[model samples]
Target: MLYRLMKYVLLGPLLRLFWPAKVTGLENIPAEGGAILASNHLAVADSFFMPLRVPRRVTFPAKQEYFTEKGVKGTLKKWFFTGVGQFPIDRSGGSAAQAALDTAIRLVREGHLLGIYPEGTRSPDGRLYKGKTGVARIALEARAPVIPVAMVGTDKVNPIGSRMWRPRRLEIHFGKPLDFSRYEGLSGDRFVERSITDEIMYALMELSGQEYVDIYAAKAKELLAAEAAGARPAVPAQTSGARDAARLPESKAG
Candidate 1:
């Protein structure tokens, strides 16, 4: 297919010539099987560079907005992602999240290599953030192994505002797979899911060597943007009497 041709025949050689990289831990990857490649997302190029390093094809969930943009650029992006076997799904709605998870589970069952960024979004400051539980959910639900990967120096290759990738010294490190087989049938337990997700994040932190921040990347970006805009931080609602020491008096019945 065109995807294989692009990955192995066409683009593969071109990348070797222009974007040569040192990839380690290939032995950690199964020659053939369903597994999750969970990694710290540094830049947009992580999507392409990660898959390009592995001999096996990787499929990742993409934002629907990427495929729905309103211009020739959007069309090209849609075509590229589609041709590379990436599919877009809604990420905001609860039902849509479940739908995307189901799609991932199906891919795992089909023995496809699934690449996931537990951080859910690119790190705004290149620091590793707490991972979302979706990775754990997918791994547990599909009974697949999760491999922690680290992409080094990719942000420099394709940093924010960069339209195209510039040649850089990129490295791909694949760590040992984290097995969650003991948590079988516990996917419905949120605490279990969190524990699994946290374990995966720990592995990523060790592999990536990036400073760890106990917050989601997207939320951290929001806070940074809010601070930049000089917006007042919202106050939490008072839920207890002690928290309502300055509460207004209630009106008596007239």
Candidate 2:
């Protein structure tokens, strides 16, 4: 009850006022039943903004730290996330990933909308990276349509290192649902996982128009952090001459 009230009456209105979002292709989202909204992660605010645009309550997996903190802040964080329908997922590898996948599958099976970012972390350079195969696995297991959502200009609103949000023009484009019914039972095969993941990433690439890097999100984050900290020497201009020479096309939506 609180979640619905807050979403419609308070949080949603305030977010729209500040961010001034323009949403497109909202009809692509299923009005009823279960589905997966696979989006490109560009900033921390992506989670909040995406949910506010969607009419139904979309539940996303949040890092366990949000729920494990201590004292007054911890309690507030727990309540806030819970009220917003986000559940904690242990991000550590091995059993944790499996557990998170299980939780997501259970939610979808129960007719809930599951929001997942295939990159698994916020993109540092605002470029879309390769999607992790977990999303493909879940979609296949749950037999849910995966809606590709692209968020533009969110990084400008709340870029990394900024303490507060800056009013910016945010736009969310929802691409037509990508159906993977043909790969229904092949979720266990590694090759199938990779193929499905690649397909999803390709659809996102068309929607987001960001340079696609075939690397995981964690590695990119580490490299960016190290570069920012000056621990690693900066790449000389000469070394990047080849990449610099190439003319990259700007995103039409951005």
Candidate 3:
């Protein structure tokens, strides 16, 4: 299969040679059955290194545009992304978002390892952002365990705006699988979902040692941009969680 070929023969070996990733607590990955590998989003390369280090095929939902283009260039892109173990999902909100969530649920139910970024988007700064509850919903709906993963040093290798990857050491720390079995059959409860999401984010914060920010990463990006443009933007309502109180860092050029 293309996945195996790229992982073993084509891309994996080459990446390992250059980036030299070291993994800790890899035994935390289940040998079989469904589970969610929830990680903090730092840089684009988080997607590349995480999957290469894991034994099983890890699938992430990519923007639908990655797979929907036409012509030779589009065809090549579609092939490349598919070979690299990504599938298309509509990220637009409403029904389209629900449909993507449904697809994620179905993947886990079918005994696949679903790689998800609970933060929804990469951190604009290096701080951990508030997680979206989608990961909790998937775990509850599929009745699967959530394994918190922290990818370290990737932001240095592929910084926020860099098109090229630098040779830097990578570390993947896998935390113990979090069981939400007590919340079984409570998938639709928003409060329960938020609680689970917060727990996951706290674990990530501990593992990666990144400062926690209460605002969503996308919103943080908007604020950073607004500040860059010399505009005073309205600060969003902040969450009251313990980690949420961690002050947002001053914006810097990436």
Candidate with the greatest TM-score versus the true structure: 3
Tens-place lDDT digits, model 2, residues 30-122 = 998889999999888988899988989999999999999999999999988977779999988889989999999999988999999998888
- lDDT by residue for model 3 over 1-254, one digit each (tens)? 99899899999999999999789988999998899999998899998899998889999999999998999999988988999899999878799999999999999999999999999999887778899999999999999999999989999999988999999998999999988887787889887787778888888888888877777888888898998898966445343552542221111101
lDDT of each residue in 1-254, candidate 1, tens digit only: 87898788877778778778889999999999899999889998888888988888889889999899979999988988876768899988899999998999899989999999999889887778778888989999899999999999989988987898899879999999888887788887887777778778777777878877776778888877886788945222222321121121111101
lDDT of every model, 2 decimals: 0.82, 0.82, 0.86
Candidate 2 residue-wise lDDT at 152: 94
Q: Which candidate number maximizes lDDT?
A: 3
Error of 2 at 165 (Å): 0.4
Ranking by TM-score: 3, 2, 1
Q: 209 in model 2: Cα distance from truth in Å? A: 1.6
For all predicted structures, in order, the TM-scores are: 0.86, 0.88, 0.92
How many residue pairs clash (N, CA or C atoms closer than 3 angstroms) in each of the candidate models, in the order given? 0, 0, 0
- The better candidate by lDDT, 2 or 3, is 3
TM-score, predicted candidate 3 vs. hidden true structure: 0.92
Residue pairs in candidate 2 whose N, alpha carbon or C atoms collide under 3 angstroms: none
Q: After superposition, how far is residue 6 of candidate 2 from its true place, in Å?
A: 2.0
CA RMSD per model (angstroms) = 10.4, 6.2, 6.3
Once superposed on the true structure, which residue ranges of model 3 sit more than 4 Å away at CA?
A: 233-254
Over the full model, what C-alpha lDDT does candidate 3 score relative to the true structure?
A: 0.86
